[model samples]
Target: MPVANRIPILCLGLLLATTSCERPAPPTTAEASDSYNLAAYIEQQQERLQAEKPMVLKSVTTEEKPTETIQTAEIDWEDELSVFAETDLNRPALQEYYTREERVLPDGNIVLEYNRVEDAEPLVHYLRLEMTPDRVLRQLNALIQDQNILFYSRRNIQLTADPSSGNISGYRVQGVQKLVLSDSLHYQIDANL
Candidate 1:
């Protein structure tokens, strides 16, 4: 064939190949709506789900019961104060002149006894100073109010009046004194009135 005729034939083949490779058209909105019914499709899906067996959940009941309950008793303030006063008066004073031996209970109650010199009633009078629960607590609080003071002083921990007892009798005292150390250790003293 002539070159001009061959060129036209090749052009025609290329045009046919390109035209044959067209993509399918997208579905129209009406066609898509007809294909899937929203309500009926959901109902059909629900029916299929309902036809399957359901998972069983067991509810467990506990059989264990609590064992014990704690109960506390009320304290007697008058008897407590009387006992403290007697104990303090009976304690023996230290050997040194005008010195007294003081004993502190685990609860911070204090007992002191002093020796009396001949004709020196001053020591006895001084020892007779009245102590009220509030007074004791106030004095103790003053000593331990500051952390610095508490750490430095060995005598920082002291008894305070018990708030519960103090209300019944203004003179009743009960409380604990805790001396905290730098290393987080604590020395506890307790007293009650």
Candidate 2:
């Protein structure tokens, strides 16, 4: 053939090769069996890995134990005066002045001792309360003693705490306290606490 005819034939062959370039067909049975074996081996390995791994804490606890429960109180009822009396449990919040102690007497009664600092003044408050371990209020002896720095006229105090609630049910405090700043003096203060 002529060179012009050969160039046209070469262009047509190049165009066909570019448009319909194809690879050899893969072997069907061998390839499919190999892929299926690999997938099954991977799934088996995953199952073994899951079986070897330890169970989570939440799952183990849920299976073996109940959900949750609150325990009973361990301390004596007298010792829980701060909680029952509606007082602050954190001692540092009260400038570390308040203290509580519990003791068992020979008569099977509990003695609750409290030493609290007067927030309003510089005086100290001392209290000794006697009660039963099962929340029975017997008696309370309180002393709101005076400090020489300020003029305080105190007569008498009568207080009664509720057995169940551990709070003051009937209270009578009679005293006249004057702050250091002003000249105005406060008179008798008798109120139910």
Candidate 3:
């Protein structure tokens, strides 16, 4: 074949090979284990609140000032619920780092708790969830801690929801942070949706 004809054929072959190659699919939240998909749950909540645009009453308290309360319909659901979202432990990388325990209380409520392994120091040290017998979410609580030479931080995050509707009623985040050459800072945020 002429050089020009061969060049066109080679280009066609390259295009077909590239197009036929399969890209690996992203891991789903459920792939980790038989655990609750916290990331998916938070995403659903975000979508619901974003569509509803409900009025939010939020209060913030910091070491530098007194508590300030704000009420408005302009709420950033994603940001407001980010702590809960970040507490997701279902990532594939974390599947083996923690163990999940479940129990049913006398009141018939189901509780699920996740704790890190004896030697692992994961970002989320502990996570607990309270749910109805039918698996309706009631509350979620998590503790996140990180420390290094430059800074140290700890956060206790909680989310309360209506069991019947699975709608978040309120949430709270209490944290303390300390950085080199700076005094420890304490902050708390309580919000109702």
Candidate 4:
């Protein structure tokens, strides 16, 4: 063989021999288990997240209510007879339905009276108010608040009125009280009014 051809063959043989003689290094603890349990870990995380999550309602509904209001102007005066007659009698509208009288008794007390000429429901037909301005309300209150057996025993009404006009006014209520101890007593008083 030629010297040049011999040299090339020897070099190629040396390269193959050196490569085959070396051994691969052993794996360390961290690199030993390169394969992963990725699918199992993902499934476990999904279950834990579902367990910790709050429950939610699928659907809900709500309702609202309507309200109504009445206007004052629509109210009728005739319908409010009980409320109207309870005010001062000086009102011509009220006076037109009744006859009014005023008297001053011996003890310096003023008395004002009214009698209904026409029938009205839930209304007092006779009203007699006594005024003693100097007296305290607590003393006079009983006469107006409660039916005095002695005074209402026959045909009597306790009145509250306007001092200047002698017109019947209110005391807790205006004019005569509809409630009497007896309806018969009220009728007896009604005959007088």
Q: What lDDT is reached at residue 97 by model 3?
A: 80
lDDT of 4 by residue, 1-193 (tens): 9999999899999999998876544333342232122223224433543444322211111123222222222222232222323333443234456665656679776555666675542134555545554321111111122344433322222323345543223223222333354343222111000
Residue-level lDDT of model 3, residues 1-193, one tens digit each, is 7898899899999999998785434455443455666788899999999999999899999997989999988987888788898788766667688888889999999898989999998889999999988878899999999999999999999999999998899999999999999999999999998
lDDT of each: 0.33, 0.44, 0.87, 0.37
What is every candidate's alpha-carbon RMSD to the true fold? 40.8, 34.5, 5.7, 46.7
| Candidate closest to the true structure, highest lDDT | 3
Assess every candidate by TM-score.
Answer: 0.18, 0.33, 0.81, 0.27
Q: Which model, 2 or 4, shows the larger lDDT?
A: 2
Candidate 2 — number of clashing residue pairs?
0
- Across 44-147, the per-residue lDDT of candidate 2 in tens digits comes to 43354344432211111122344432232232323222212322222233335656677889988777666774564423366566776763665555556465
lDDT score, residue 189, model 4? 12
Give the lDDT ranking, best first.
3, 2, 4, 1
What residue pairs are clashing in model 4?
Answer: 86-174, 128-159, 129-159
